[model samples]
Target: MQIVNENNLGEFLERKALKCKEAIKQNASLLNRFLNLCLVFDECKDDLDNAHILECSSFKELFLKKAKEEDGYFKITQDIKALDFMQLNFLVNQCANFLKSQGLKANDKVASFLQNSLEFVILYFACFKSGIIFVPVNACYKEDELAYIYEKTKFNYIVAEDELLAYVKCDVLKLAKSSFLKSILKHKKDFIMPKINPLDLAMILFTSGTTAKPKGCKITHYNLLFAGYFTLHQIGLRQNEVFLSSMPNWHIDLQATALMPSLRANACFVLLKRFSARRFWQQIVFYEANISEVVPKMIELIKLQNKFAREKKHKLRFLLYFLNMSNEKYLEFKKRFKVDLFTSYGLSESIVGCIGDNYYEKMSYPAIGKVFFAYEVIVANIKENKLIPLKANELGTICIKGRLGYELFAGYYEDELNTKNSFIDGYFISNDIGYFDENALFYFFSRNKDLIKINGENISSLEIENLLSSHKKINNASVICISDALACDKIIAFLELKEYPYKEEVNILQKNKELKQIEKELITLNLRLAKFKQVSEFIFLNHLPRNYLGKVRKNVLGEIYGRN
Candidate 1:
C-alpha cells in the first residue's frame, strides 16, 4: 500500500527526477518518452539479494551491492581484459584494510600518484570506504610540483608505482611493489566500513594556480553524487551501455563524465591508459561503446589522420567536448561521423558548471547549454559584498548559487584566506567571464585572470615566468597565451638578456654558441615543467615592456610579439 519505499530512497529519486524534469521543461516531451522506455525493463530487483539492496545509499554502496548480486558482472574493461564487479570489489576491500592497518582514520589524506589502471580505481573506492580524502596528483608531475603538494597536505599514505617512487620525499607508507595485487589477495576481504557522511571531504582537487600557488578545492561525497545523477539525467544514458573514457584521472570531468554516471546507470566503463588517435576508434568498436569523452584537439588530430571509414563504423551516440569549437568544425564532424557533439564549460571547483547538449532542443554550435538543475547561474558584476545583475548579452563574471551544502564544493582544503575570498553573497564566483543570450544558452569568452588553457590543461602564465626567471643569464621574462589552432593556446616566453651587445656578437660562430647555450638552459628548465606547461617558443628581447611601477605589461607583450 506504500507507493514509496521505507528508507526514503524512492522519495529521493522522485524529488531528483522532478528537479531534472523541471530543469529541462523546454523538452518535456523528450523526458516523458525516456521515462516510458525505462518502465519497459525490470526494476533491477529481480535477482539482487535484499541485503545487497538495503545498503544502496551512494555510488560505492550500489557498486558493492551489484558486486555481491552478480559476481561475474563485467564492470570494467582495460587493455583487453574485462574485470567483473566482484574482482574489483575484492581489490577495494584489500586497499581499505591496508589503509586501516596503517592507522589512517577518517578524513586522513591519501595521495593517489599512479597511472590510470585497475589499481587507481581500487584506491579511489578504497578512500570512499575508509573515509580518507583522495588527493589526485597526475603521474607525470615533476619533483618540484610533487614536493609542493606533499608540503601542503602531508598525506599519511601514498599509492604509487615503483617507477614514480623517486618523487616521494615524505616518509609515508609507499606501496610501490609491482606484486601488490598478489600480496593484497592474501588479506581478508572482510573489512569494516568507516562512518562516513554526505558532508565529509571526498577529494582535494588543486586548481591550475593562475595567481600563484595552486589552491585545493574541497569536494564532498554529496557533491560528487549530485553531479553524477545530474549528468545521468542530462545525457539520458541508458543502462548497460559502454562509456569510453581517456581523460586524465586527475581531471574532475573524468569522474563527472564517465565514472559516476556509469556507476549510477549500471553501465560498463572502458578505461584507456591515454588518448591515442590510432587506437581510439578501434577500442570503441571492440567495446561497442555508446559514448566517448574527448576534446577539440583530439578531434582535429583524428581528422588529420583521415580515418574516415572507421569514424562512422562504431555506435557512438555523441562525443563530450569541453572547450568551444567553430560551427564549421562541429557540423562537419556531425555530417562525417553521424554523431552529435555536446560541448560544456566547467572548472575544477564545480564539475558540472554548465550543462552541455541535452538532445531535447537544438542549440547553437558553441553555446554551452543551460544552467544545471538545483543551481542558479547569473552574469553579474562581482562587487565587494553584492552582485549587480547584468542585462542579456552583457559580459560579466559568472556566478552560481543553490544547494551549496549538498550540490556544490565545500571550500578550499586548508587555505582559509582563499576560501573566504572566493565567495560573494553566498554564491561561488567563477572567475571565467561569459554571457547568456536571450535563448538562455551561455557562451564562454575568456578568463578574467591570465590563466591559459592548453589542450584541456590549465597553465599559469606566472608559473612559467617564475621558472624562466630563475636562469642567471635572463634578466627578466614574461609569459602569455597565444591563439593556437590545435590547443586553445600556446605558451610563449619572452626573455631579456642580462648583458646585451656581448663581444661574442662580433664573432658569428661564437654568437651562435651563445644562442645555443641559452636555448639549452631554457630546455633544461622545461624538463621540470609538465608537458602541457612547457613553453612552445622562446623569444629573446633586449628589454621587456614595463609600466611606471615596474610591472611587466603582459598585454603589451602579447600584442607586439604574440602573433604566431
Candidate 2:
C-alpha cells in the first residue's frame, strides 16, 4: 500500500463516486464553487468578521444547492435546513440566557449528561456562546464513574436527561450537590447570556481509562475552532458535503473528525444514535452521505453484514478511520468498498488532529501521515531529558510543538499537578512512542507506559496484541506483563475465543483443552518476541474488560492476571 498523493486522491475520489453510480462531474462542479467561496472567505476575512452569518445557514444553502442539482440527493439524516442552523443558534442563545437568569455566573461549569442528540449540540453551543464551560460526560459511564468526574470537574450546573438524574446520589458526595430540578423550580425567569471569548473553556473531555483512571482534558473555543478549521482543510471537506458521524460525540475522535469539522465547513452532519452494522449501508444509501468517520472495530463488524455479503458493493466515497488498519486489510477494504480510506493518529490532549494519511497515497508507509498545519513533530529521548531528532526510519518517542500545539487543552480539570507533569519544558509529551519512516510518515508503536520492561528490554504490548488479533480463531486478545517472583515481570497473554465447542457440552476438560490450544498459539507468537518479552503464561477469559471507548482495560487485566 503506497502513500496516497494528491493525484492519487483525485483518482480515488473519482473511482469511489463512479462505483456509487453517481457522476462526480456534477459534484466536482459544486465542489469547485464551494472551494472557491472558501478561498474567497479565507482571503477576505475582514468582511465576514462582522457579518454575524450563522454557520448552519451556510451549510443549509450548500446542502440545498447540491440536493437540488443532484435530484433530491440522500445527504443527511438530520432535518438540517438553513433555518435549523439559525434556530439552533437562537436556541443556544435562549438556553444561555436561561442559565444566566438562573444566577449562574461567567466561567461557571455546566455539565451535560446526554447522548449525541440535537439537545447536546444546543447545550454545547450554548455554553460556548455564553461564558460557561461545558463538561460533556460520557453517557455510557456507570453512576460511580460519572460521580467521580462530577466531583473532579466541580460543575456548578448540570443539564441531564431525566433518566440520568437517577444516577445522581447526593449521599456519596461530601459537598452538597445542586439539583437541576430544584433550580428550575426556584428561578426559572432570571436566565440571561454571558459574554465569552475564544480563549474560554468550551469542553472538558475525559481520556478513556485504558491504563489508569480517566483524566479530563480541558479544551477552549479557540482550540476547537483552530483544530476544526485545519481539519476541514486537511480532509478537503467542502460546504454541501454530507458528513456522517457514527462514533459517540463525547470522544475527541468524533469531535475532530465529524462535529467540529462539519460545522467549520458548513457541511451537513448526520448523527446516529448508535452504530448499527445492519443499517450502516442502508443509511449511507438513504442519506447519500459523501463522507464518514469510522473505527476499525466497526469496519470489521460492517464487513460481517449480510447485506454487504449479498449486495456485492456500496456507494461510499470516503471513510476516515481512527485506528490503524493493516496494509493488507487497508488494500482489501479499498478494493471491496470502492472508497478512499484515510487513517490518522490523535489524542484528547492535542486538541488538534495531529497526523493523518488519505488512502489514495501510493506509499503504504506506516506513518500516521505528516504533521498537521502549523504543527511540528519531534522524536525525543525522555531519560536524558534531552531532545533527539531521529533520522527517518529510526524509532523513538514522538513529540509535537508549534502554534497548533498551543491549541491543546489548557490542562486537566482541577488536576494541575498532572497537567504540569504532562509537558516537558514547552513541548507537550504525548507519552506514545513512534518514528517517521523515509517518507516522513509517522508510525505509532505503543504508549510509553504500555511498554513492558523485562530485564531492561522494552516490549510493546500493542504489537503482541496486534499479532494475536490477526489469528482467525481469536476474537479478542490483551497482553500484559505480570511480576514473577524470580524473573521479574513476565508477559501474559489473555485471550477470548470466537468459538468454544465445549461450552454447549458443559465439559470443563474440553474447555481447558481449547484454552491450551490458544496457549500453544501464544507460544508460537512468543518466538517472534524478545527473549525477556516472551509470554510465560496464558489466561483464557470469557471476555476482556474494556472501557467505555472499547479499549481493553489494561489496569483491570493487570490485577486479574496478577491474582491468577
Candidate 3:
C-alpha cells in the first residue's frame, strides 16, 4: 500500500468528523425523546425504593430518624418554648395518636384554624405521619368565610383555638395558644402508624378567595418533600441555619417555602405569632435569623415605619421577597435596613419558589428570575387551538410543566372539570401574562384578566397600583377597569389612605383637604403618563378588601364599583 501523506490523512479525518456531526444532528430529536422516555420509565419504577419517597412514604420512623440526623430544633416565641428534634418528634407522635383516637382515618380531613404557633405546625406535620389530610384555615377568615370553607371541604373535624371556636361548626379540639403543649401532653400513647404512600394527598391549601371562591389545591407528600429537596439542592440552602417567619401557617409560602425547606436542611424555624413591623426587625436580631420571607406589603409597611439608623447587628442574609416594589424603594429599603432582598416567585400550585433572582444589580426592574429546578417553564401563546412558544420580550401567558404529585400539586380538589380545563397540552396554564428577557428572566406584568385594553392599547393594572401605592398618602391601592363596556375600559384606582379611621370618625375638613390635594397630584400624574395609561377616576376607600395574603380582590372591587 502507498504511504499516506499528512495532508491526505487530515482530509480523511475531516470527512469522518463531518459524517459523525451530521448523524448526531439527524438523531437529535429522537435522542431527546428517548431520554425523556427514560425519565418516565424511571418514575414508573420508583416505589418505596426511592430514598426521598421511602422516607416520606412512611413518615414516623424515617422522619424521626432524619430529625435525629440533623439535630434540628424549633423555638416558639409565643410562650418562649423551645422543642428539640426529639421533643418535636414526640409531640407529633402524640398529636397523630390523638387525631387517630378521634375516629379520623387515612385520607380523612382535619381543618386547623390557628395562627402561626407550634400547635398549628405540629398538627400539620402530624397529619403526614397519621395519613390524615391537613387543611390550614386562613387566620383572617371570619365566620362567613369559614362557613364557605366548611361547605366546600365538608370537614366537620376541626382543630380551633379557643377564641376561634365560635366561628366553625365542627367536632372541635379547641386549644389555648399558651397551653398547647400541655393540651397534647395529656394524650401520651403509641399508636400504629398508618402506611403512607408518597403519592397520597397530604394537604389542601386554598387559594386567595378574595379574587374568587377559594380552590383547594391537592398536594402530595412527594410534592412537599420534592419542594424541600429542590430548595436544599438546587437553591443552595445551607444546613442548620435559623429561619424566622411570622407568616400565617395556613399559607403555602410558610409551609412549602419556609417550613418544609427548613425541615430538610436541618434548620431551626423561629416561630413568631404575627408580623409586627415595629418588632419584626428587632426579633430578627434577637433570634439571629438567617432568612425570612415577606410580601411587598410587609416591606412597604416596614419602610413606612422609617426607623432611623441602619440595623447593623442582625444576621439576616436576605428577605425571601415577593410581589413588586419600585426600583427607588427597593434600593432605599436595602440601604436603610442593611439587609439584601432576594426576589422570588411562586404560587400555591407551583409548590416552592420555582423561580428566583439573587443578583442585585441586574434588577433595574425586578425579574421573576430564571426558572429553577426541574421545572419546564415557557411563555406561550395559544391561538386557533394551537399552543405556540413565545420568544424573548414577547408578552404571553406563563406556563409550567413538571412531574405531577412530585413537583406540582396533583390537581384542584374534587374539581375534575376545572382541573382538566386548567391544563393545556400537558402544561398548567397560569392565566398570568408576562414576558421573558433575552437572558430568560421572566417579568410579571399582570394577571391575564387584570390586563385591560384602553384605547386599543394594553395596560397592566398592577403598574398603576404600584405607582399609586408609592404615593405618600396611599396605604394600599388596586386598579381596575370600569365594567361599562361602553366606557371603553376606563381605569379606576381605589386607594386606602395611611391614617384610615372609621369613615364616620374622620375629621371632615381634614379628609376633604387630603382628597383635593391628592386629586391635584393625580391630574399632574395624568399629564405625565401615557394617554391610554391615565386613570379616568380614583376612589378613596377606608380599606381595600384583601385576602389573608394581602392580595387585593379586583373581582370583588369590580363588583363593588358596579353597585356604586
Candidate 4:
C-alpha cells in the first residue's frame, strides 16, 4: 500500500468543481429557453392551465432540444440525452400500466433477456418507472443458464428479444409454473405503463460466471442515483460531453461508468453493438467522443494502430478506462493520442465504479482512489465464519457498508445458503481480498474463491497467468485446477502460442519449434512454482476462450480440457 498525495486530490476536486459549474450553467440556460417557450404557448391558449402545462412542456421541450442537438452532431451513434430519459420513463410508465391492467403488482419481478440496444434501455427504465424489479439476464447465457435465473428469481413477467424468445419454455418446468407468462404474452402489446418513485429497485445485475454460477446483485434507484452522481462529480462530467461506450450494457462498466454518469450529466452516450478494433478510431472520430470507457485489452488493440493511419482523426480529451497499463504503453498512448487516461474499480455487486483514480494525479501504484460518497469500505479478515476488520495496509477481504452498501442485494436470488453466508454483521462481504494504503487508497489482490489450494498451500491463479504472460513465445495462457482422483486437484496449464502454423505461409516446422519452446517455458514455471502448485500436465490450444471483458472462463476451459 502507498500513500495518496493530498495536493493532487485537491487539484482533481477543483477541476471537477469547475466542470460541474459549467454543466449547471448550461442546464440553466436550456431550462430558461424551454420555460420562455412554454410561457408564450400558455398566453395564446386561454383554456390551458398555464402553470401545469408549462411545467411538463418545459421539461419535454428542453429534453427534446438536448436530444436533437446531440443527434445532429453525433449521428449514426447511440447517445442518451434528456429526451431519451423522458421517453424511457414514459415508456416504462406505459409498460407498468399495462402490467397492472393484467393484475400484476408493483413488487412483481420482471426478467429481461435482451442485448444492448434502444429497446433494452426503454424496457429497463420502464421497469424502474413502474416499480417492477428489473432482472437482467446475460445475453451470452444459453437456454439452461436462462432457465436457472428464471426459476430462481421466479419472474412474473419476461420481456425477451425476438431471438431469445424461443428459450423461455414455461412448459418445461415441473413445479411453480409461471402463471403470468400467459398474461404477458396475451397483453404484450397492450400493457399499460406506470410511474415510479426514486426509491424503487431499478435493476438486478448478475455476477460474472468465471468460477461458479452467477449471483444476482440487486440495485435500487437510490444506489444508482448516489453512485451515478458521485461518478459524474469524480470524473468531471459536463453537459454536451460525448461519451463512447464499447463494453456491454449488461456489465457494470457500461451501466455505472458510461451510461448512468452520462445521463446524470446530460452528456451524450454513444453505444456500439459490439467492439471492432479496426473501426474503433473511426467511430471515435465520427462521433467526436470526449470520453470512452474501455477495458485494458481493448486499449492494447487501439495502441497497436499506426499513428500515420490515425493522423486525420478527432482528438479525445478524457478517457475513463482500466489501469495497470504498462509504462511504455502509457507513455506511447499519451504521446500519440494526447488524452488523459483514468482508471476505476468496482464489481457488479458493488454497483460499479465505486473507487477511481484520475490521470492528473501521479499513479505510482495500483490505487483505486479514496472511497466515494456514502460508501464505507474496510478490509476484513475472513476466519472460519467470522469477519474481522483489519488495519490500514493489512491485507484482508473487502467489506462495504452505508446507504449505498446495503443496496448490494438482499441476497442472491434463491441461493439462500450462499447469500446468508456472504454477510458479516450488516455489511456486505465483497469476497475480494485487498488492502487500503495509509491515505485510504484501496488496492485489489485476488478473489477469495479463485485461490487454488494444494497440499495446504494457497496459490493465486492470476500469479501463474502473469508468470506465463512474461514469456515471449506464449501469447495467451490460462491456469486452472483439474480434479485428480488421486491428488485432489492438479495444476493444468493451457498455452496459446504467438507464432502458429499457417498453411498460406508454409511455416509449420518453425511453428512446431515455437510450441516446443512454450513447453520449455512451462518447465521453468514448474521450477518457480511450489511442489504442489507445479503443473501435472500441459495442454496446447489454438486460442483461449475469453469473455468480452477479457476474463478467461475456467469452467469452459475445464469442459474443453476434459473433452480433449
Candidate 5:
C-alpha cells in the first residue's frame, strides 16, 4: 500500500474537499431517490430476466425453483453441505412445519445458535415463512453471554448445533441431523400462513457488547426489506450479480448487504462457514463474485498477503468497506489495489446511515458520505439536555430518524426505559460522534464514551489513533482514556508494529534498538498533535484485542491498563 508523503498530505486533503463539493452538485438527483425507500424497486426494469424478485412468481416460489432450473444452482453453501435451492426449500419448509407442530405461534422467538452452515440459512428462511421471529446468536458466545440473552428474551425454542448444546441452559433442538428433518417431513407440507404486516417483528439482532450486556434490537419485516432496497440502490447491485457472504449471520451487514440484497436482486450469494483470509481471494475467483463485504481488520490482513497476482486477478468490481480505518490506510489500500471501495456509516440499530457509494464521485476517503434514502440524520450536542443541532463541521452525537417506524429498528427488546431514552423528538440517539461539511459529506469520530478529557479539553481518541496509524511502522492503533495523576482522564495509546524485526534469538542490544525505533516514531507523532491531545503513554503489543464483531475492545484495554 502506498502512503502519501507529509509534503502532499495537505494538498491531497484540499483536493478531496473540492472534489467532494463538486460531486455533491452533480449528484443532486440521488437525493430524490434517497427519499423514496419503497419506490426504489420500481426503478428496476419490468423485464422478467432483469428483476430477480418481481419477475419471479413470488419470493417463496422462487426459493425452490432456482435449484431445479438449469440456470439456478446452490448459490449459498459451505463445506458441510452445498444445498441447491430445492434442498434449501425442502429444509426450510420442513423446519417451518416442525416449528408449527411444536405449537410455536407467529411472532414467537426462536433462537438460532448454530454455526455458519446451510442449516443456519435454512432456519433463517424457515422462521420467515412460518412468521417466527429469528434471533441469531453468535456461535462464539460463551455460556455467560448465552445465558444473558436467554434470561432477557425467554425464547420459546432454540435450534442449536450438537457441539454447542452444553451452553443451552434449557431444552433445545439439534440442527443438521437426519432425525430432525424426518420428523419435520412427517408433518403436512402445507402449513397455515400467519397474518403478516410490515411492522411485525421479523428478527431480533443483539449488539456486540462492549462494556454492558448485549441489548436486542427489534427488526421488522419492512425494516429488512427497506434495508435490502437501500443496499441495492446504494451499492448499485444489479440482477444476477454474485455476492460473497463470509461474516456471521449475527452481523446486520451480512444480512443487509449479502443475504437480503441477493434475495431482492435474485443474485447469487456464496456463503462460507467463516472468514478465512487465506481463502478469501480464491473463493472470490472460484465463484466469480462481483461484490464482497469487509471490515478494516480484514483488509489489514489481506494487505499482508504476498500473492500480488490475487490482488488483480479476480472478478471483484468493488468491496463494501466499513469506515473504521485511518485515512492514510484507506487511501493506501484503494490506491494500491485500484479497486472501488464503497464506505458506509451505519450501526446494527439502523441497517444504514449515510451511504458513500451514491456519492462515489464526490466521496472522500474516511468520510461517511451522505444520508441514506428517506433517513434524516444530523449531529446534535446531546451533552446539552436540549440536544441542539450542531452546525456544519461541528462534531457531536449522530442522531437519525427514518420515515417513522420504517427504516429504523422497532426498539430494544424488553427494555422500555432504554428504548425510550434512545429516542427524542423522533430521532434515535446514536451516541456516536460525527460531523458533516457544508457539502453534506459526513466524517465519523470516536464514540462518546471513548473521548478523553484532560486539562479541560475533550480529546477524540480516534484523532490520536488515526495519527498514530499514519506512522509507517505502526500497523494498527487503539487509544483509550486513563485516569491521570492530575485528577483527569489521559490518553493511553496502544500500537501494534507492522513487523517485528527482532526474533526470540535476537541479541538484547537489537531488541533495545527495536524498542527505541517505536519510541522515536511516537516522538514524531507527538509533533503533529496539540500539546493537550498528545498521548500520555505508549504501550506496544503483538495485537490489539477485538470483540466478536472485530471491533476494538477499548473497555477491556482500560481494565487491563488500569491495574498496571
Candidate 6:
C-alpha cells in the first residue's frame, strides 16, 4: 500500500503524539519500532474512499505530478548541475528505498546534520516517500548542540557530511556523504512505498527558545503545502520563475518559502551552498533568477562589497528581504541596485511569510504588511481573563489564528505543556509586540525579544549562556549582542572566573598563563559554534550586573563590553 488508509492515519497520528509525550517524560527509546514494512492496518481500508487526506497533495503526490514534467528542474549552482523533474523524483524514491534497506520504519526518525547540499534535499523528500520523520539538525551545531538534539530526538539513523562524522557520538547507523551519494545512484530497489497522510509529521525543526533547551516545531505535510501556497500567492509567482536563495536549507525561509513554493507553483529553484557577498549578484545573473531571498544583513554585506557593477545586468525581478533596515540604507540600497525588496515577517513556529508586504503597491519600509489568507492575525492582550483587541495604532501582542497542522505548526515536538501553554483564547500568542495602522498595515516592533538574529539565523542568548556555564573553569557566563556596521549583531561573552578574579595577586603570571590556556580552549569551542554564534570577544567580569529582580542586565553587559 502506497498510502495509509486516511481513516486510520488520524488515529495513528493521535496515538503517535501521545507516545511522543510519554517518551519525552520517560526518556525512553522506541522499542520494536521496526514494524514489518508491509503492515498497512488493513482493518480501516473500508473507510479510505472518502478520506480528506486523499483530497490534499502530500509530497509524494506533488512529486508524482511533476515527475512527468520535462521542463522543470532545480539548478544546484554549487555543483554546477541541474536535476530534471523526472530524475529528482526518481532519486528521492531511491533514497527512500535505501532508508528502508537499513531497517527504518514509518514514524522512525533520522537526524540530518548537513548543509545545503543535494543529499540534504533528497533525504528530506525521501522521508516523505517513506514514512520516517525528518529531524533537521543545524549543520553548524557543535558537540553540545548536536548532543542535545540527539538526546531529544532519539534518532535511529544519522546522515552527515564526511568531514562532520567525528561529531556524531552515537553508534546508530551512520551514512557519510560520500558513501550515501554513491550508494543511492547504483540501483533502484523494489520496496513498498507507504502512503502518507497530509497530517503526518514531516519535520521537526528546532528553534532556540528563551530557556536553555531549543523548542522543536512540528511541521506537518499540510503545513508545508499551505506555507508554500500562501507565499506563492502572496508574491504572485508565475510558472517557470526561477527562485534563488543561499540560506541554509534547514531554515524555514529556504525550505518553506523558496523551495516548497517553487514546487507548488511549478517554478524552478536555484540552491547555493552558502551566502556570499562577492558572488551574490553574480549567482543571480548567472542563474537568471527572477526572485531571491535575503536578509538586511546580507544586503548590508553585499553593499559593502561594492561589486554591484560586476553583475549589474542581473535579471532578478525582486529581492525578498526580511527584517528592518535603516530607511536611509533601505532606500539607498534600492536606488543603487535598482531592485525592489519584498519585505515579510514570519517565525519558525508560524507559517512562512505569515505576515508580509504587498510589493504591488506603494511600499512601506518598516511595516511588514498584513496577514496572508487562510489565517487571521490580531493584536491583542489577555487582561484579567478577558481578551482585549487593540485598536489601530495600539501596540499589543501579535497573535495568529490558524488550524494546527495546516496553517500553523502542529506544536512543539514532544513538549505538550509548552504547546498547550502557547495557545490562549484560540490564538497562538506570538509574544511579539506590534501594532497595526488605520490602513490595517502591521509593523514589526519586536519578535523573539530575548533572541538575536545574526545573518538571518536566530540564536538564543540563554542557550549560549547555558553552554558556556558548563565549562569547569568558568563560574558563570553572560552573553550579549551588540550592533555592528557589517554583521547584523556581534556576540560578546562576559565570563566570571573561578580562579582568576583579581589582577593584583602575586601569582598573576601563572594565572595569566592559565587564562591564555582557557582562552585557547574557548577558541576551539567557538570554532565549533555556527560562525554567527561565535563571540566577537570575551570579557572577564567578577559578576554580571543584575536588577533588584535578579535578572541579568544584558544591556549592562553590552555597555561593559563597549567600555572595555
- In model 1, the clashing pairs are none
Q: Where is model 4 more than 4 Å wrong at Cα?
A: 1-105, 171-199, 209-211, 306-315, 323-325, 358-365, 387-393, 404-407, 449-564
Tens digits of per-residue lDDT for model 6 on 1-118? 1122222222332333344345335642212111100000001123233132233222123223332312222221113334534445556667877888889989999989887776
On lDDT, the stronger of 2 and 6 is 6
Give TM per candidate: 0.81, 0.64, 0.67, 0.61, 0.66, 0.81
Which ranking of candidates, highest lDDT first? 6, 1, 3, 5, 2, 4
Where model 1 places Cα greater than 4 Å from the true spot, the runs are 1-78, 308-310, 383-386, 403-405, 483-485, 497-516, 546-551, 562-564
Best by TM-score: 1
Query: Could you give candidate 4's per-residue lDDT for residues 306-387 as a string of tens digits?
Result: 5545434564766775534555766776687776667676666667566677434554234667676556788988778777
Clashing pairs in 3: none
Model 2, position 116, has a per-residue lDDT of 63
Candidate 1 local lDDT, 139-169, one digit each (tens): 8788888888888888888888788888887
RMSD of each candidate relative to the true structure: 10.0, 15.0, 18.7, 15.1, 16.9, 13.0
Can you give the lDDT of residue 187 in candidate 6? 49
Q: 227 in model 3: Cα distance from truth in Å? A: 1.3
lDDT, model 4? 0.58
Predict model 1's lDDT versus the native: 0.68
Q: Rank the candidates by TM-score, best first.
A: 1, 6, 3, 5, 2, 4
Residue 527 in candidate 2 has what lDDT?
70
Model 3 lDDT per residue over 469-510, tens place: 778888877888763422235788887888876453212223
Q: What's the residue-level lDDT of 415 in candidate 5?
A: 83
Model 5 residue 21 CA deviation in Å: 48
